[model samples]
Target: MRLTHSCIITNEVKKLSEFYEKVLQIKAETSGDEYAEFPTDCGILSIFSFSLQESLAKGSSLPGSNRNLILEFNVANVDDEYMRLEKLGVEFVKPLTTQPWGNRSFYFQDPDGNMLNFYTKVK
Candidate 1:
């Protein structure tokens, strides 16, 4: 089955949504203050309020406890993107570097400490 979207559960929906909007350069379609989504070429990146998640499925998921998952995005130029994000004062977990797999990439974290990666394939 094809994946449709990935959702991040957070207590601060507005804050996290705004962060993603700035990083991705896309406006989110929000549902009140409980949910927001950024539609991308691959799929939708969504944020759900912890309250909303509890109401829907109690204790099914935890907010701001992501330690193993890294959301990766493919960009045209990783260096340019890194520079732009740096100017915005984004919290970077790792600086821009070339991977052993021949990808130029960098890692950063959201306000909720969710890890994200932007990378470009070396030609």
Candidate 2:
């Protein structure tokens, strides 16, 4: 089975979309006033406004709701990406560090404090 998308619900679709635009270096397609989707290489990352969430049974509790799951992105060069993102004022939880598992990695947070990892495999 393939995972088509990983969706995030927030009250700020446009703001969050803009955040991803800078961080992911991709554009977002707005479905309406309340939703936008980024078509990434692996899968789509979507954001929905609270207006859309209100239409559902429960309201969205985004931003700081998730704690355990991390969103990871693989890059051709982790250090280069780190430098680029840092220049864009991205806040990192961890600086670039080579792991024992043969991966050079770093961690950071999105505008909503969504944990993210950018890494590259090293032999």
Candidate 3:
């Protein structure tokens, strides 16, 4: 089966969604006060809220409250993308570096602490 959409749980979904829309140039739609959906070239990007009390009661942690997951965006040019995004005030874990796999990449974190990587093939 093909994947359709993926979601990140945040305490402030609206704010995070707006950040994505503003900084990453993603146009996202909000559903009342619950969630946001972004239609990308490949698939839909979704963000929703997780009530800490309810999730803790159910013994499940919020999606990004813990590590072990990473979301990556592939770009045509990592350096150009990094400069553009940096100008928009996005925080990067590190500047774009060339990987042994013949790609230039960098890492960052989302509002909820989900690790993100942007990569492009090195020529």
Taking the candidates one at a time, how many backbone clashes does each contain? 0, 0, 0
Question: Which of the two candidates, 1 or 2, achieves a greater TM-score against the reference?
Answer: 1
What's the true lDDT of residue 112 in model 1? 95
Tens digits of per-residue lDDT, candidate 3, 4-123, equal: 887777778777887788756878788777788988778888887677435545645455574787777788788888998888888998778998988899988887788888899877
lDDT of 2 by residue, 1-123 (tens): 999998787767788899999988888888877888988789998887766676684644554576787888999999899999999998889999999999999999877777899999999
What ranking of all candidate models by TM-score puts the best one first? Answer: 1, 2, 3
TM-score per model over all chains: 0.98, 0.92, 0.85
Give lDDT tens digits, candidate 1, residues 1-123: 999899999999999999999999999999899999999999999999999899989999888999999999999999999999999999789999999999999999999999999999996
| Runs in model 3 lying further than 4 Å from the true structure | 52-57
Q: Model 3 lDDT vs. the true structure?
A: 0.79
Ranking by lDDT: 1, 2, 3
The runs of at least 3 residues in candidate 2 whose Cα sits more than 4 Å from the true structure, single-residue gaps closed, are 59-63
Global lDDT scores for all candidate models: 0.95, 0.85, 0.79
Question: Which residue pairs clash in candidate 3?
Answer: none
* Worst ten in a row by lDDT for model 2: 57-66
